[model samples]
Target: MSRLTAIIAAVVACLIFCLGWLAMHYHNAASKQQTRAESAEQQVNAAEAVTSNVLTTMTIFNTISEANQHAKEQIALDASGASADIKVAVASDDCALRSVPDGAVKRLQQYADGLRQGAGGSATGKPDS
Candidate 1:
């Protein structure tokens, strides 16, 4: 009878040890899974941020392009009455200042100034020519 009781006690001890080992294994697996899930979530957020930035940049670029086209059209309309053989004087030296502005050069400078003003007037780079 004593020997049988000893055998039963040994079996209970073995069962308890096995349960503890299984619990530890489950905890380790759960921890690893949680870490992986967090990493995946972080990556998704980063990708979304990058996509949003790229889209915003593209929108700005398109706006600037449209404004530039509009400015070109305005300039063309304004210059319609100008002679086809318009002469633009060129400075031989970069440091030299022209004594008098050529007709075409003066118009170009005026257009540039208009463009600067328009760009400052709004977010878009449209010139108020």
Candidate 2:
């Protein structure tokens, strides 16, 4: 009777040890999975942030390009009109040539030529022969 009781006691101790080991094993596996999930989430967030920045940068570049093109076109138009106005005023005696500095007129012509070339506009403000 003592031998049977000792055997039963040993069996219960072994079961308890097994159950504890299994619980610890499962707990470690769950912790590892949680860590991997968290890492994946961080990676996803980083990718999203990078994508957003890239899109914002592209939009800014596009806006700047458009603004530059528009400004160039406007400058070209203004140059052509100024030269034309000068020629008309001279011919009609609306303003004297001396009143308009030759140096300023030359600089304006140069600037207008560059703007027209860049903007792809035909030169229409030729001085009267």
Candidate 3:
């Protein structure tokens, strides 16, 4: 009877130890899962913010493009000798100009260069009369 009692005690101890180990393991796994979920949420939020910013920038760019086109048209019309000074004044206003597209400023500079050359040629008596 004494031996039997000792064996039973050992079995109960082993069972208790296993239960405690399982509880600890479960707690650790739950903590890791929670951390991963929070990390993923943060990433998603960052991505959304980036997307929203890009969209806003694109909208602003589009608005600028449209305004630039309108201004250019007005300039062209004024170049035809209709209220030239007014058109030039409007175009000269910084706020009236659109945010030039990437590389567009270079193209504009090129056009300006051409105009300068033409003006110089005309002034030098090389007009294509």
Best by TM-score: 2
Residue-wise C-alpha lDDT for candidate 2, range 25-104, written one tens digit per residue: 99999999999999999999999999999999999999999999999999899989999998777785745634768978
- The residue ranges of model 1 lying beyond 4 angstroms of the native Cα positions read 81-129
- Residue-wise C-alpha lDDT for candidate 3, range 93-128, written one tens digit per residue: 876676768676775666566677775643454433
Candidate achieving the largest lDDT: 2
Q: lDDT of candidate 1?
A: 0.80
lDDT of each: 0.80, 0.86, 0.84
Off by over 4 Å in 3: 81-129
**Which regions of candidate 2 are displaced past 4 Å?**
90-129
Worst 10 residues of 2 by lDDT: 120-129
Listed per candidate, the RMSD to the true structure in angstroms reads 10.5, 8.4, 13.3
* TM values, all candidates: 0.61, 0.64, 0.59
Candidate 1 per-residue C-alpha lDDT over 1-129 given as tens digits, one digit per residue, 9 for 90 to 100: 999999999999999999999999999999999999999999999999999999999999999999999999988877863534343333355434545559767766766776767646322444445
- Ordered from best to worst TM-score, the candidate numbers read 2, 1, 3
